[model samples]
Target: MAAPDKAQQLEEAAKAAEHAAQTAEAAAANASGNAEAATAAAEHARMIADQLAVIASASPISDFVFLLTIFMLAIFVGYYVVWSVTPALHTPLMAVTNAISSVVIVGALIALGADLSQSANSFAPKLFGFLAVALASVNIFGGFLVTQRMLAMYKKKER
Candidate 1:
């Protein structure tokens, strides 16, 4: 009877060991699957990063092209607008343009007054601001002269 009880205990221990081994095998399989998924996810992230890097490298040229297109369109539009105005409205238009030049002068003055110590590239702004002030000043003075001449043409001649 004692020998039979010992054999039964050994059999139960063997069964428990077998169950533990099976559980460990299943856990190992799940871990390997997770590792594969992580590797695929990392590869996908790397591919996206490469695509973004390519776009970033090409961004400046695209931005320049876009701005050039808008500038060309503005030139065409401004030409058409100026050509379409009636002759009688020319004096008023000149006055408006002079006003716009004054606004430009104000902006240029602000730019000129900006602090140069904060930036290494500040000279360009100052130079362009000076040019803008000079050009706008010319535009304002010329526009007023043209307006005066146009108004004079409309005045009654004294006998």
Candidate 2:
């Protein structure tokens, strides 16, 4: 009876390990499928981005003028919004502004670095990138200074 019980236990253990192995394989397959789908999505996004770049380069002068107009409008809107914020909210606003300025800096850097090897039509983007970098730098530094000043106002005066 003892011998028969030990054999049964060994068979049960082997079956459990087999089931575990199958479950692991299924999980690995699922992960592989997810990875492949992600790769395909990334590739599609890259293709779309490439198409947009080409379109931007080939776009008409009116398109450029329209974009410039939008940029100008944005500046006006930002000015009004910033000026309207109350003193109590100014520091938080400045922090948000700094975060946005950081994003602008990153975009400017990407614009500067993009297609460095393309000799044709590269100068225009590079010039714009340089301007963007300069403007973002000023915005970021200025925001920091203003935030510092605002924060200072909150501190208790030392005896």
Candidate 3:
């Protein structure tokens, strides 16, 4: 058999190399495109998860209102104790103040229990309302005791 020409061998070798390089380039492009798409999809999923977390962590407006109310009760109790400690205040004022404080507590309990049974439009408002009211009652009762003690101390001083 005649020896293959050197020129033909060289040409064949060049063609094979070109074909391999082209295939490699195409494969690399495909891999890079898939990676880019995967990265984008992952970022999108992470963003959605963050949004859901924010929504889950957000508190309702009613809950905020209830929390504010509890804070107010604490302040009220503090104010009452301060007032009861002063000796210049009269007996009638002390007695009326204590009675009024107790009455308001009963009113709060009634409002709270009512709220539990009746929501804005539904049959049940929320059970938390009752708990809030009960806690408020405790604050008022505690304030009254403090006030009574202060009054007793003042009366002993007067004698």
Candidate 4:
């Protein structure tokens, strides 16, 4: 209303604004402190989680599952090696390899099979089937003979 009264009102308003700024600064400091505490707590929780993961990963069940997976993978790799590595298997290597794979699979099946034509609990059929196939494969392919000849040549040279 009056100029002097308006000046007094403006001075009071500035003091109130300074007070508000101080309160806001305090609140901001408290918030930053709480955020730091929260960050520390989260870091602690993450450390616990990492320790638990290490323990769980090294536990017996996890180890067993990991080893079993590796073994299966190794068997698959062996199958791949056998299929591709043997030069003597020339024309029908794939077919022969398939036959070999089938025989081995039959043995595995026999190992897991509900026995048939023998003891109800027996794995004889699967075992016998795989054995017969293996023997026949050796006879037909002469792989053993070739290996033996190579061994004999090596021995002769060594002698």
Candidate 5:
């Protein structure tokens, strides 16, 4: 076979190099496009996850309203039941009520005594505690006086 000419061999080598460079550029562009698409997909997934987290952490207003409704209903029921008591039994009932209120006074005293150092700085809780104690004390004394008056009325008259 005849030896290939030097000029022809050089021309073929140049064409092969150009072809390789073109193939490499096309592959790089395809890889860049794939990377961009993957990045967009990851960002979308992250956004969805963040939205789900916010939904999970949020409290519903309707639930709070339902609890408030139940509490108000209980208060109304208690008021009606107390008002239905007979006058003759009122004194005894008041005594029992005063006894229950004593527990409230104790709780209030505890709240007032806790963290004495902070009492001077934060006054609202202490003030409420003081009010609770005063009100409970009044109820206890008033209940005892009413009971004494009712028992006196039932005393037998001397001949």
Candidate 6:
């Protein structure tokens, strides 16, 4: 009876060892799959980095061409938009443009106030800033005057 009990205990221990070995094998297989996926992701990131590097090194002429294309598109769009508006909406549009000109004035003032002690080539910034401020001021004042005149036309005349 004692020998039979000892044999049963040995058999249970062996089965448990076998199950543990199988679990370890499965875990190792999962780790290997994860490593392969990580390698693939790293390769994809490297490819994108290479593409961005090429674009960054593009020539100045290409950059200029791209900007010029955008500028031309803007001009055409602006012309169409202005022409498509009804005459009655022009006053509101002028007021909006005046607000935009005020933003330009703010930018000009920032440029004008840049520290001159940092660089000897400060004159160009000052000159351009002054011109921008002057032009934007004129545009704002003119737009307001036009808007005021347009609004006046709609008022009831005095007897």
Best by TM-score: 1
C-alpha TM-scores of all predictions: 0.60, 0.56, 0.35, 0.36, 0.51, 0.58
Number of the predicted model whose lDDT against the real structure is largest: 1
Write the number of the candidate with greater TM-score, choosing between 4 and 6. 6
Please give the TM-score that candidate 4 achieves against the real structure. 0.36
Query: For candidate 6, lDDT tens digit of each residue in 1-159?
Result: 999999999999999999999988876676556556655555655565555547657845476655565566556555655655556567978998999999999999999999987888989998999999999999999998999999999999999
| Candidate 5 local lDDT, 17-99, one digit each (tens) | 99999988876676566556656655655565556546555855465664565456556555654555545556767888889
lDDT of model number 5: 0.73
Residue pairs with clashing backbones, model 6: none
Error of 1 at 20 (Å): 99
How do the residues 35-116 of candidate 3 rate in per-residue lDDT, one tens digit apiece? 5665665565556556654655684546566556545654655455444432343444456665666776676566555634
List, residue by residue over 41-125, the lDDT tens digit for candidate 1.
Answer: 5565556556655775777647566556556655655565566555655798899999999999999999999999889899999
RMSD score of candidate 3 (Å): 33.0
TM-score order of candidates, top first: 1, 6, 2, 5, 4, 3
Query: Which tens-of-lDDT digit does each residue in 54-115 have in candidate 2?
Result: 76678764666656655665565556555554455668878998999899999999999898
Q: For model 4, what is the alpha-carbon lDDT of residue 153?
A: 56
Error in Å for residue 15 of model 5: 99
Off by over 4 Å in 3: 1-4, 59-159
- List, in order, the clash count of every candidate structure: 0, 0, 1, 0, 0, 0
Scored by CA lDDT, what does every candidate get? 0.80, 0.78, 0.60, 0.60, 0.73, 0.78
**Best first by lDDT, ranked:** 1, 6, 2, 5, 4, 3
Question: Candidates 4 and 5: which is better by lDDT?
Answer: 5
Kindly list the per-residue Cα lDDT of model 4 for residues 26-137, writing each as its tens digit. Answer: 7667656655665665565556556655766877657666556556655655455444433433334445554665566566555555446557746666667667666656
TM-score, candidate 5, is 0.51
